[model samples]
Target chain A: MSFSSTDTYIVSNALQLAVDAAVALEKPLLLKGEPGTGKTRLAQELARSMDTELLHWSIKSTTKAQQGLYEYDAVSRLRDSQLGSDKVHDIANYIKPGKLWQAFTAKQRPVLLIDEVDKADIEFPNDLLHELDQMAFHVYETGETVTAQQRPIVIITSNNEKALPDAFLRRCFFHFIEFPDEQTLRQIIEVHYPNIQQQLVTEALDLFVQIRELPRLKKKPSTSELLDWLKLLLLDPPKPGQLREWMSDEQRQSLYGALLKHEEDFPQLRYLRQG
Target chain B: MFIGLLQLLKRYGVAVSITELLDLLAAVNKGLAGYSIESFYYLARTILVKDEGLFDRFDQAFYAYLQALDEVDISERIPNEWLSDPLVRQLGQLDEEVLKQYESLEQLLEQFKQRLEEQQERHQGGSKWIGTGGTSPFGAYGYHPGGIRLGQASNRQFSASKVLDKRQFADLDRDAPLQQRGFQVALRKLRAFARSGAATELDLDATIKATGKQGGLLDLQWRPERHNATNVLILFDVGGSMDSYIEQVEQLFSAASDEFKNLQTFYFHNCVYEAVWPSAARRGEVAIPTGDLVQRFGSDYKLIFVGDATMGPYEILYPGGSVEHWNEEPGAEWLNRLTHHFSKAVWLNPQPQQRWRYYPSINIIQELMQERMFPLTLNGIEQAIEKL
Candidate 1:
């Protein structure tokens, strides 16, 4: 769903302070929030407003520092070297820049989105800090230091899976994204799914709020999850045996899995369904 | 001329892709305080673009030169302000001096090694320990000093004294029940005097005020006054990893409940977030509403957060990291707010005091709570009481 920056809820003054810090510092802002709190979408919107290319790098646990900077095509380079001995020592011929380096050296500034940075190993953040600090990096292979001609807006996101080292955290401007309150949640629902009836919206919101308050769940239903479930309900409004019949085996299982993390919570859901 | 050559080479190094040359120029530009962009550009175009083929070769050479310069600059700067920064200064006085000494000593060791090896070869199988004859040079035969003893080895072996593992302090049974003991001692002292008996000490101020109301005639009806005990809100972290210490911590909680008249108990996973509920039975189900909690408990309530502050530090940085449900904010923010609302709050960590320094999460929590974290021991509880 398309959400304007104005439409976003200003829950805590801390979040606004973080945004202001990012703008003042002119650095890529790192938003650390719970999963489904729209940390990623915030960067996307910011990039859109700035008219910068959003080069997203979805970091995984296995993502390496070198992989983020550049990947060498060793086999291709070797073949080319064999074919032409004259170009064997050419530095530019072998250089393959990664998103971080490309964004820094881009003719027009781009937004380098390092998503889920906490998932990546500790070394990844440490390696990025050098570039983040000076807005420049030296390519050792070619003996060239690529500085930002037009600095790309850098945004790093973390789910707080682990504590980032102080050295790494000190380099970037940080913000924490909080979950939307009931009013904000209602606004979001109205903005995105306007077609849904008011009664359905209220019922869904009440159920969603109750579900969030349920102590057993690991992840509270994020706004995105609420919207998805709302869509599912609207497409096929519950009839007699509708929840059982319309909910495909896969769909039902997935929904159950999302809503409930523990076995004990299953019995609690019976009451929710009845209500 | 040198600057012009450097500028010329940097401008056209792209053809040969002398990246090193460009990097060197960039580094130099960064290092030079007042160097203009025009001068840097001029230097890059002049010396770097000698020929298209030479671009890559020049880049490598340029980088090597800049690196050597950087090393020299770093070495020159190391002994001054860099050494004074608290983080670097913490390496200990011996370490700082020894590191410099080792660099010089390494060369001397290499030089001495050659001479030692030659002497060893010439001596071959010669006896260094033996004197002229079969007997040793010292006084008697077998007059060996600093050697293994020959007599029956002493069965009285030296053993390290058993240090009580600090972790045992968290074990409720091992330590004396101070709360219970204190309560018993106080009760015993109070019980010594009969309830209706004349108080040993006269309340002169009360007697004077009574005289003001009535006549100055001595009206003696002695009654002992009982002081109300202070209320305590002990929020014990239970379940998950805390399951290990559940029995011991529960004993402490139970003892506290029995000892204090106004003792209230609650359970949390790691920290006290928005609200702590009363029903320990349905801890996972019901939470005491925030409004209700504030109304019921005044600023007088002494808050003791009992937990092993061992978790991913992110829980404090991000909201929604509770073991059961996503907390709205990092536990620290809630902790900060709670501390502001309540004057007397202390955190009792089960983890050893030494290890708390390493865990960033614990350190953060400790900092937020004004370093009022104490080990969960009898002494710790007493100290917490004193602080409150």
Candidate 2:
């Protein structure tokens, strides 16, 4: 009923269609994109739009699926047993409900964001297949089963580190967040800084694209980086003519750190920088 | 329609299963795409393809399906003689009923194939090549900037504007030069992980066990983290025949540097003989001898030879056959000694696999390497890694 683009988040038609399909089919949406392409932000925006609670499961290399479902604090339990505490009698007291368990038992439908899912081991996605499929997990400690009251919207983000198992991927609606084109990127800039001059926006975007397209650039500036550069530009506004001069001659430029993240990329930037 | 699209996708080597088909059908039934070709393309792609690497294949298949779907209807509407009428295409300019005249579909296709090559040459030379809306017999082969020039869709207003006009996977296309990311991903699969470093990482399991036994006292244990101890030595073919593949070999070299902690690189021209130099940059320095190279790196190091493998058979089999230097021993003997020393040895030929049979040197090298020769492509590298 509402527009896909809100005050901040701007969704493309293709992405909106993908979202709709995933939502209608009641399946987990697996999002793959380059770093800083707003994979995690998509989950937050979805939660905001749906007015649902968000449960984030930020995975690391050593993070196990068991931790996402529930974790038993054995150290605390052993200490409690030594102290002869009454809390030791009930094993549930030591059981800490994890992100998945919290999402499952949420009062309203919630958004479960598995941020950087690929950072975990290759078999990590396979381990959660059954639980994600049924939206229910078995707690062995208390012999209790936690089931979802309302099916939560599951969104998984991957940095494309490792190929996911086919079995896990088969159950998901996949969407690759393509780097935005000039028009969409312009819209994004407008959303961030509506009062900024149109000429400055055009020139900056041109320079940004030029820097990105420099041959074999080690690291390209991302959307957030562009916003940061723009913010700095707004603070110390460069004259239209000086901006052009400084942009071409790298030594004269003051705010290149915000755009060029890698030192290795500067050699090419200097060679390819346009007047 | 979905079955047709699926068949096309499968033909393009994108693995789309029955589950994906059902998912697509469900999305369609729910009216998520709202019956628009553009929306349906996105919906179908999202439902079917999981990996971004396969997105190129998916886009190709989908585009083919859309074009083929419209082609049938458009062809029926146009006069039969309009296309089947054979005329000689003089590069971009068409000559009317002159020179080579052919009417049968086979002969027409043969002519088109010949023109296709000429068109490629013209396109590469300058930007003034004939494209869509051209009077040439093969107007479809004319440049379209967006994609490979298909039939004149602009002539007649088509019912569906091709939703995906751009080749999304042009960078990932197997025929194109390999990118650094592709090389890194392939090299990642070749890794043989071994824990061989300082035991600085805390062993949590052992710590917890010891702490339990120590009775309320915290105990910490340290163990080594899994380190990539796999050593790699790449012998690159440079100068003469390998000058064209400099960019590709450099990408592979960079990727190898990022992936393997223990890596050694050497540059040889055409074939490895008595000596190979470390890098082109330090070529003024003394070249490392083949025997010294064998002694320097361990047997566990994976030996990869990157070349076109299209040199004269004499260069490999006979002594003093190297183009620049007269080798004391034949290149074959050195290759054999190196292969014997390093159990994991492979020859990566940048030349297409189909052309390998034409090059007798490649066959000889393959036989020597025990058929561990692979084409330098995404799939080829992965298969080579598996063999490693």
Candidate 3:
């Protein structure tokens, strides 16, 4: 319990509290954040921490709540019926149990990651209200009610693409993952690159922050991008003596693509550097 | 104590359901929350608050409840009074110096720490002390190249390297009775409906036809709901000249945020520049580039410019014209880019149309806007929305 590689999840006080609240209340933890802020990663970390099986359900725009509950393969059933197969007689044979059904029937409580719940329409969350509330859903084709043997530790994430209904929101404990500060970011870097040079990390963080603060940057470099940039910097490590002076504009510009995703920001970045 | 807190929240129209209350009590009983006010606050909020929209109302109620017990506390922040004395802040002849002594952030923090120890009392309008209206590497309302702002409200120069205070949203008057019905009506006209999103609603006619084709076999069909698909990119001109119309602008902000489904608001000063802030608190901290807005949002988005459009003619025409920052490009170029990118755009000038002729800058903006500039009056907004 004291030591494990699975505990690589750097539990900030805020994150710990959020996890604690969600676990204690047995409610779905709704995590909202900007892209690459570790919303999906948090679910995996939670599962690893709890020593539970992780069940990921990546949501697409076309994803529906009904698909999560159950999908009736009527075409297969109709074809089988036309073929005069014995399997067609039983509707349960054609009933495909969805991720929710699998989670409900799991032997132990599993961590269900409903990744990018906002990618789906506004009604997506609303449609799952009954199943989420009761931890159960009905299979109309088979006339069977699928109830949870052990309620899954549900972690739903959203990028706030669209406004979720008020009713759907009330069911879960919400947590907004703000961009990590310098201290937390350092720990995060340490988690990824354990034996990285301190001066390099400091200088990289400094320049990274400066670029983020540049007025009217189209896309600020995210946590993942910072980590990715750090990896690139670590490859060709700068001299310890030259750490005081930031990388030259030309040198920086070569690696600038990682920091600034948008081409429009390149000109602004130059302006910031000069002024 | 918990019940009293719940009651207070209810009184503030937070709509905390009975089940949520019971769940909160259950959590307390289970020893989930530590014997701390903050832990209790988080736990209660997590249980009670259902929607993000109610977060403001919940925060207000929580503060009011805490205030009753004389335990109201602001988040831990660098002392504001230690930095500035706002009363004595002289507008004229403000010291403008670029403090680049600290080469790096670590060095800056070290200097700040040393200064924090040496200074015993508050000082204002000084070059040395971490006070306002000075060239110190700390505090706001001062000119410091890459300084950490202690408090002093929103950033003016966009030079504060970092802000220490926990950012808070401006308390919107949501409960205030809608005094302007015409304004709301005008905003409603901006709605453009489309069935573009994921299929969420049952297409009854399609389902029926599918069922008939399948010879009595139940077939289901889903079609996306018809929603207000109009994308609105609203750029609000804040600070200088626009200060008088804060109340009016706020009303418009509130109405637009409520009415439009896909509304994106950005703040600029006087005219469109290279960048715009998402909020006033984050003005200096981060700026989303105007180019990014053009790239992010398509030409379909109705670009609505909310500003007085009244500034020096040089401000719009000449580069480095902006009083705050030395904008590399002229304001007119950016406005032209915005108009070109967005086929549907209108400038909502808070200034009266009659007074527009007096201001040369307004006339310049009108020409760039293709004479699509309208007054902030109800009728003017109606005409603008109709044109959109």
Candidate 4:
């Protein structure tokens, strides 16, 4: 199904407040929520709404602060300097701007989405805080401070793994996005994957609501998972002769992972597997 | 308009009865409209004052709102009043009961000791156990005729000549504790900094004045001295689940307390919400009054929140999930306020590096912290201290 602006649902007043702040303050909005709460997709939607370039930075545990700003191309610089030492005197010429710097210097204000910031080290957040605070960063090699011509709207996402320092939080407006309710989740599924039967949609949402209440699950199934499940059911609708064929084995296994996380939860999934 | 006036009074932290709220609301030009202004006034007043009956009604209304919004059903209980007289009385009674039980336990222990001594005497063959292997005067099991071994033959006895020479064993002093080494290194660095004159500028005016007293002839030699005024706010997580990592955390807490000037410590569990008390034992004692807290310490202090952020994610999302007390807002709100007040802040997590990813609550906190949470390693602590 083709997506539209009206299709997007804003559940909480807090989220609306955050969006308003982002617009008023002209600052990067930082979103914190659970894993399946559509934090990354919000950035995509925001980019679509503003008609801006969405520069995505998927943060990992090993992500470094310097990597976000600039990278040093030492190999090429070393070759040139060695081949022609007298000609290539300026050693600082090897620095190349990374995603953050590129977005800052872009002609249009890009949505710089720093996804899963909690995965990055403490230094990374500290580094970003300074940049966010001043809207500028200094390149030691160039001996010049590069300021943003147009401040890129930055969105940081985290599934609270560790307690972030308060100093860094003060720099940005914060918002928590919770999981959508059953009605909203159903609407999302129907809007995203239209071919699914209404009955199937209702049944899936009912099952999802029930499953979410189960304490053993690690991460609740998100909107994306709901759509995925519907797509699978539509591709191979349940039949008396081939009830087992309704969900592909691979899809079924992956679905279980999304639904069940604990050993005790396996027994609860017997009904789903039986059909 | 009357309801609005009542709300104003409530906001001003006034304790108004239901009738008073209605009267105040009625006094205003805008009297009770079609809606139950009296009811709404009472509801809002009870919510503000946190009256149990009113609070329950407010909670029901909140739940209804959540239901309408299609949010998850959050089944949580409102925290009991920490300052309730009944609760305090019950705690005192419990303490008294515990003391009485301890005394009874001591008496039982003495009786057990007496029985043990009698058994030992009987085992040593006190003239009556030679004929039969029956129950002796001690009223115990089989015994040795003359206790198993006597004098030099006893394994328990250690003679001075039999003691092992210390020189033959490995020298334990050579391998000192890591904490000692770290302390020594820190001391050495402090001494070096002292010697290098990386301190306050000398008081030239005072020196010149002193020299003038000696007929303008220079008698005093000028040297810079260190003006060490390090202000530290160490927010330690104590009580509840924090009991597990008390030893290591205590070490760090003590170290920071000794090293920094103006070092203040407060106890919190999981995450800080609203206010933190000075002592964990008397969290509800009102030791640091709310007014005093806000006045004495604002945002200028450097805050260090020490805890393992292993809590239900709802603790930050919901108001009532906190362990110590029910906060009106989520823990994040308090954290945000703290950040606004403190120029520098850092979180120290004792949980190891590998396990942080598994906990959603910790992940959420880390994000709130702007990814400023660091593992509580030796190097991490040092870096944190240096940053402070």
Candidate 5:
């Protein structure tokens, strides 16, 4: 069971090996990288390629580890009991299943994506360590151990917001996804915009890579930003000129909104040559 | 089991444990790496090394182990009987890096002793003697990280172990270019969450009690959402010696803005004399007096001071010792005043922690801050946050 690049998503050689090892070892693959290296998109592509379910649990600052397992709606149950509703009798009705539960009981082995794991509290990963290792969690209310019928492939992404706990890191097969190079970037562009002219992509990518390499950029434009910039470029394409001369002020500076995310970087545009 | 490789990794301070080695063995048993050493290398890396920061060390260790195996000469080989023992094979290699470490250490200590004998007063520049910003391999601010750095006790026993233990990766990465991401991550630990925002979340416990008291009638309750209520007051020492740390201080400034909602920053020179300005642009203008600042921010705010803290002892002790203007009170008085108001206060010194004791001004301020001065690194920030 090897993961290959899909029509939409591209997997580098290193990432492929990491995913394979994690899947084989039955360990969660902890992915870390810059914001837009497509760490979240890997799980989506993997599920699509495998013809399986993709269970995405998007984490937030307020998110708790308990929410991933299950949430008991005691307030709803109490309200139903007050109204004398028949739903109050069954406690299981109020025990709403979370992303983990759904993944656990799925007929087919799913790809469970715990996106932005670092956004939550520091103790979040530590709380889920046992469940992740055992592939089971005990429901105190239901008095039942919810064990995974088929262990799903888990992929967790972190924006490097906080340093993860060591014990949690020890259990994971870690892989850092670096920004794709020119060759890979070109391939990514081709896959996304099949009808786009090759010359235009080559020219745009050359300028993009140069812009990225410039020092003191607060936020380097990633692949997603490039795609957006390209999309905007496609609608009203820049006029054809010499390789360096083609990208004049009117063509580049006017589209600064799509490329340069920060106001400080607008001044950095002056450092770039027309070529 | 690659016991030799594991030992080599540990010797290089990679911190590879038995559990990680077992994980590597498990991967090998599952035929993850068939016949290719490259596959095995990747497999071992993915299993053993847990951080990207240690990648450079592991890369060197892994190659060194492989080279040791290949470079085993028949002439230098140990007896056939002892060769079978992994520990014997590992020790028999006699790594060149180990020899180089020992050689450099001896050379460093010998030179350091000679320099100490020649030096008299505190030296700053020039290549010779124990000083700063020179090609000298004996003291602080020298480009060499592996040099023997003697703090105040140059006559104390010069340990070769301390000199050999210095690996340049961590220091190099932090010193090459300052990143705000590291500061932001460190500052995140100083969180004090309080329910301060609008009442968006449902107060379930209160609702249930309210409903029960109302004769089984349903009554809903609402409460404010939790927000980070950590108020931070940062005083940055600008100009002179602090110019070297401007990049780091500025990065911290930006990161602080991103992390805290109630952050107040002020600029001071050398030390906080009587008043601190609001910004570095208009430094001559005093925005707020140091006395009023104590009452304005209150004790609830966590006070942070960013500076190199390298100045004359008189500047902190005497009233007329300020470089810019004559003052009624010394800078030490202002620091005491601030710390008295804000119980949770910490001074972040950009100067390396090892060199802190050499500066008398730093010692005076440290005593004034009650030993709350911390180095402005990730580990230092974590410790500071814990104290706060």
Candidate 6:
């Protein structure tokens, strides 16, 4: 069969190939893209299609590799020990299994998503090298090695916040979700809003394309933003030339807030309007 | 077949492990990757190719390996001579009948499609064939209302909607232009201090002092927060008008790399479009969204924009002014966003201060920077550092 799996995410041929390759290799698929490019949604869709449980690990600035493996509740254990509780006798009772640990211990192969891995410190990816490579980690406190029942399909996403270490990069397959081309964007919009008027979609798309090409806007409207704008447009449809001529300057500038995310971008809409 | 392909990829500098190779084979056997050549290529690349940076090298290897194994060469996939330039033969004048027939864009496109199939040999300055510098419906540097350009270096005319080029940012020479000592002297002015962060290391002094006050009792103390570390965000403009300043800019970049511990560098061409790349070669394939970048780097980052600030006024004032891509927001909007986020910011221009008045874009940038623009000279560097 062709690589394009029947999914609502509308995976392009290139993306489909990348997915197939990652699946075939049993390596983690490393996705790098701008915000609102559907990196996280792709993982969710892939898991749904493959009939696997989704195990998500949303990384934060303070997120550490040890937290992904297993968190030792030493403070809780100490409190329990002082209280003379039965749970205080065993360290394993207080061990909270992390996302990776849970994925590894699952009976079936799970889709483990490490979302926004770049949010963590530079050393975060490197820290996961051992466990990701070996597919097992020793619970030193419990003296038990937690090994994978089946190799879980891993999907890692990044917003390109930080450059991942070369050592960490070498273990995974990489794919970049580029800004969707016109045709792809059209298809995406259609998928999300099936019954929307064709004229509105066309106008909004054209206006979006024009706004994105504005020379001075800091934050260009992304795919998600485009969808949101389209939803807004559907509420009160603009006249045929309303985007260019009909709407008042204030109204036009206020409406531009949907497409241009930055505060600095609002003033620049006047220049774009002149064009 | 898979092993041979892997060997070929290895020869071409695409590192693939034995386990990855095995996985590719397994994928093919299980029908996860289809039987088509296209599917196989993608499968092999996804499994074997680890780094996104090595994608161009992988493509070259894949094309070479495919050509060697099969008698048929897929020239379309590879960057060959056909994609380089139009054949140099000249058919100076436009044929009246041909001109009439190709009056509309649709007619010209139709003829261009026919020419793509019929014309195998390279030709230039011809009305009928797909060649350069002619009234032809196809190829670059030709006079056409709407033509299909196969391969061209720079888009002088805004006629062609499609473009194909294999140039990458990493291929550019990154050697320092200035003397090592000179660079060091210029870079010393940058002040860096680690202040706030999650406490990891133990503060022995604090721990000991606290223990003495507690009558010899044990007191564990974490390291002082270093979260408010001095961070520097460098936006280095490459290509187009900035070509002359490459050497000096490279020196500054080298100096900054050596001097700053918290340096975050990104590469842009002409202007910071919607996104920027770490390397030139990977620019087309990989880019960090400019918006995400603003959100990622905090307000404390010292933003140093390095560029000539010399370009067509359209590039700054109008949409679709960028030479490389049709950027939605003008370059000025992005620059302003960056400046707003980074209170401490400066634009270092390599073009001598004397030439500043000549370029309108320079004036526009200066105004945008609120007169923070400075030259790349030693004196200029000192002034810029002082401001920072």
- Residue A82, candidate 1: C-alpha displacement in angstroms: 3.8
How do these models rank on DockQ, best leading?
Answer: 2, 6, 3, 5, 4, 1
Candidate 2 structure quality by residue, lDDT tens digits, A1-275 = 33277778788877787777777788999998877777898889988998878899999977999999999887677677767889989999989999999998999988999998877777799999999999998999899999998778899999876667899999999998878877788999899899988878888887888887788776788888889999988886667745667555556465888888777777786666656
- List runs of model 6 lying over 4 Å from the truth: A1-7, A246-249, A267-275, B2-19, B51-53, B68-128, B131-223, B226-388
* Residue-by-residue lDDT tens digits, candidate 6, A200-258: 67766776777787864546788988888778776777776555553345565566677
lDDT of 5 by residue, B112-152 (tens): 56666666656554446565433345543333334443321
| Residue A258 CA displacement from its true place in model 6, Å | 2.0
lDDT comparing candidate 5 with the true structure = 0.77
List model 1 lDDT by residue over A1-275, tens digit each.
12134444323333443443344344566776567787787767666766668889899866878776776554455556546656657757767888888887777777788999877655678877777778777777777787878767777888654446656654555555556666667777776776767776776676677777665343466877877787778766765433444444555655655455556566555454444
Question: Residue-wise lDDT of candidate 3 within B165-225, one digit each (tens)?
Answer: 3322222223222223335545766766789789988776787688789985668789987
- Candidate 6 local lDDT, B137-235, one digit each (tens): 666566554455554543344344333322321121112133433455556656554656668766767866876687655565787554525578998
DockQ for every model comes to: 0.01, 0.39, 0.29, 0.01, 0.28, 0.29
TM-score for predicted model 4 compared with the true structure: 0.42
Q: Candidate 2's residue-wise lDDT over B1-388, tens digit each?
A: 4898888888888888898898888878877878677778788889998887777677667877876643222222222222332222223223323312434434544555556555542122222332333333343323222222333322221122342222345455655557777787678877666776789876768978888789857666789877677889899888777877777788888899998988988888888888888877635768888889889888988999999988899999999998887788899999999999999889898888888899899999999889999988877898898878
What total of clashing residue pairs does each candidate reach? Answer: 28, 1, 3, 16, 1, 27
lDDT, residue B28, candidate 4: 31
C-alpha lDDT of all candidate models, in order: 0.54, 0.76, 0.75, 0.55, 0.77, 0.72
Per-candidate TM-score against the hidden true structure: 0.41, 0.82, 0.61, 0.42, 0.80, 0.60
> Looking at candidate 4, what is the lDDT of residue B163?
14
Which regions in candidate 4 have their CA more than 4 angstroms from the true location? Answer: A1-13, A85-87, A239-258, A261-265, A270-275, B1-388
Predicted complex 4: CAPRI docking category: incorrect
DockQ of 1: 0.01
What's candidate 4's DockQ score? 0.01
Every candidate's CA RMSD? 37.1, 7.9, 13.8, 29.5, 11.9, 14.9
Ten-residue segment with the worst summed lDDT in candidate 6 chain B?
B168-177
Which tens-of-lDDT digit does each residue in B111-170 have in candidate 1?
324333433221111123211111111111122121111111111111101111111112
User: Second chain only: TM-score per model?
Assistant: 0.46, 0.75, 0.53, 0.46, 0.69, 0.49
Candidate 3 — which residues are off by over 4 angstroms? Answer: A1-7, A241-252, A271-275, B7-15, B50-64, B67-388
Worst 10-residue lDDT window for candidate 2 chain A reads: A245-254
Q: Point out the higher-scoring one by TM-score: 1 or 6.
A: 6
lDDT of 3 at B367: 95
